[model samples]
Target: MSVYTTVSRDSLQQWLQGYALGQLIDFQGIAAGITNTNYFVTTTHGRYVLTLFETLRLDELPYYLSLMSHLARHGVACPAPIADHSDRFASLLAGKPACLVSCLTGTDVSHPTAAQCRAVGEMLAQMHKAGATFPRKMHNPRGPHWWSLTAQQLYPQLPTDIAETLAEEIHFQDGHRFDHLPSGVIHADLFRDNVLLDGDSISGFIDFYYACNDILLYDIAIAVNDWARRDDGELDDELARAFLAGYQSERPLSQAERDCWPVMLRAAALRFWVSRLQDLYQPISGELTYTKDPAAFRQLLLAHRCRSEFWLG
Candidate 1:
């Protein structure tokens, strides 16, 4: 069974006809995402991805569409949405807005190695550099302040340890010490599933829903946390070295970026922890869904805090 929300074949055909994508020969639902309903649509013309907007507002969509277009033009390896015959990217589907994007090749690497992490880091660096001049600025939507408030509301029964950690983090956040760090567009969430690898090299990257105006170094921290670290809670020195080396090969990070890496790592860990805990306690209502363990990131956060000095060395 596919994780994508289902629609009758007739309904799908009707929708395709409206977009002039030709008759739908066959389509398969994509089970890759938890946030949106997705399907790989095959038509007489070619294959494309159909995405039904989930949590994003209609007003918030142009940022993603524009971002994708910008990245595609700037030599970024990512999917670009295809416009319909009428030059419209969105259409109503089952009473919700939906859009189509060209299907990108390459497999999603579940267990990426250190070399792959390096490629991803390089790509991320290039992505941030290109997006630095992005004209339209949008909020992170999942920043620490937002997560703190969500923690108070959703996880009111959070364990004492977790609650205390959150309180301390909030206190530090109030000082706005990190505000002076380099700021730019950031892909706040880029888990393993969001990145695709061809052999040991990254072939493509997807899922721009979390792209927003934030610290560029924080984006690197998120990638390192997911791509360069392992489940046993140890940061692989080779992975970190390879990844950072690759990033510096492209758009080199400034001294400020390096200096703030540890704090950014801590912030990244907490953001994921809050979201995972939200899913664990108040699971979203859906037919096919999987919840991530907040404990995993909590342990990772602790580990990073213990090795806080290594970041400088």
Candidate 2:
């Protein structure tokens, strides 16, 4: 969920049968996400996920659904978009684009271990490598350019002291001082909750709403910032080593990839920091949505800047 989507049971049922798929046996709202609302929809054939898009354009949804179908067809471990009887991937429901996706099997990991971090890194590396050939182009919403725009809109709403500092960071990015990073389709946001696990092994990844074209190293940095960092806002070397080693086992990082890790991680920190602050101050006014603390990543960015090598190793 992107903080702006909602789902209704009646509309879900209507869309399911209207698409000529089948009767929806049962559907319930999934409370774990903060962006678009989701439901685990069960039917006679099988269980599928129904997502009500909140932020994306209706025209852009085909790219998302098509990309999922393509990734699943290519053996990438993710929830594939389930097509309707007409082989249409999407249907208009209550004036919103709603689609069904194949349900991935696994439990979401709330507190991941080092081994899990390594597995996440491995799977994500494979995703990036495979996604290089994914046949669609979607611009990442949290890329530097978008970040600058977000800073402009949200900076004033932040606590007075941090606003100027964030604006300076935005100015620095605008100067083109941090623009030399390889570009590709990236997950952009891969928090531990997004990675599913069965026992000690990773089963699949979910929540592709943030997927887009951006620096590949920045993608890794997003995962590292989320998975390989300790609760005290310090990068865990053991976790980072495990993650990087597992990722390298799939696709080796270029020298450029390695050299850019620190700034990329810092950029990732800034990305989440800005987003979390936006959500914190401008929470969605709705039935059931909670705000996340921006301070988590605020402290994270401070620590990373103060001790760059903490994330370097």
Candidate 3:
């Protein structure tokens, strides 16, 4: 949630008048993420998050907002988009597509414990089940198609070894198919910072901008890659096992999902590696922006390549 566009107090006050929400008490920019401009807005009624779409177009927003509403209504612990007096979820703010969502109660757990990982896993499974009936259909923007294009775009700027690894991985993934696996709406960017914890229990999952329809196992792979990793970029056995146990308690993984886990893990790693490289090389300037290290995910991809055993085992 970087601050790209600045919002003045008067401007925000005028905007809030359209909503039933009371006067804006205070607001501050959030600087933890790299995507959109986010602010923690406090009003006389309650707390909410005001997000200004950076890259996502206005026409492309309904799927995300509607998915959140669908999941929240089905008992998934996620933020609910707040509509204005006119019953519209999105509006123009600072000449950008903007919306308000209820602020969930909790803090992010950076270094989560095994129990916390379990909670996240269970919640993720529930989220998947809740979103299964959602009517919208949107492709995973950072899936294989995007990866191929982004890999080509970054190849000229990357080291030879990195470029070779990316090309080889992309080629392998292009040939492999998991069409038989179950698919649904997935929170593709459920890293630690995106989930909030009240104590050891997960309060809510945030940052649904990357949500899309994809293979369910791929979503699990993305979460496992981030949530079950040790300091050395190796998968933590205890955390991985606990997480899978929790997820299976709700929605069990099919035999195909288990058999294809290794490849899915590698695919998840590649997705982040390419994105981090793009952020590092072609960064967008903002009032408060943070570009994560591309080398971190590069090391992770190499580790996944070398490790043959599934972490969940």
Q: Which candidate is the best by TM-score?
A: 3
- C-alpha displacement of 266 in model 3, angstroms? 0.5
Residue pairs in steric clash, candidate 3?
Answer: 1-33
Superior candidate under TM-score, 1 versus 3: 3
CA error at residue 90 for candidate 1, angstroms? 1.4
- The residue-level lDDT of candidate 1 at 164 comes to 82
Task: Evaluate residue 89 in candidate 3 and report its C-alpha lDDT on the 0 to 100 scale.
Answer: 85
1-313 per-residue lDDT for model 1 (tens digits): 3434567788888878767677788888886677788888899988998888766666678888888878878888888877677776677776567888878778887667768877888899889888977899988878866886887886468878888877776666555556777778787777788987888766677998888898888888888888767768677777777778788888787787777777778788888888888788877676345786788887878788778444333
Ranking by TM-score: 3, 1, 2
User: Clashes in model 2: which pairs?
Assistant: 1-35, 1-36, 2-35, 2-36, 3-35
Query: For residues 105-192, could you state the per-residue lDDT of candidate 3 as single tens digits?
Result: 9998767898999999999999999988999999887878888998888889888998998898899888788889999999999899
Which lDDT value does model 3 have at 96?
93
Query: Once superposed on the true structure, which residue ranges of model 3 sit more than 4 Å away at CA?
Result: 282-289, 311-313
Give per-residue CA lDDT, model 2, range 1-313, as digits (tens).
4424455677667677655547778877776676575778888778888887766666878877787777788777888887777788877766677788888788887667778888888888878878878888987766777778778888667777789768766665565443566677788778888888886677778888778887888888888888877777667888888888888888887776777676667788888888777777766676344667777776777666666453333
For every candidate in turn, the CA RMSD to the true structure comes to 2.4, 3.2, 2.2
Give the TM-score (vs. native) of candidate 3: 0.92
**Span of 10 residues, lowest total lDDT, candidate 1:** 304-313
As a whole number from 0 to 100, the lDDT of residue 149 in candidate 3 is 92
> Model 3, poorest ten-residue lDDT window?
282-291
List the lowest-lDDT window of 10 residues for candidate 2.
304-313
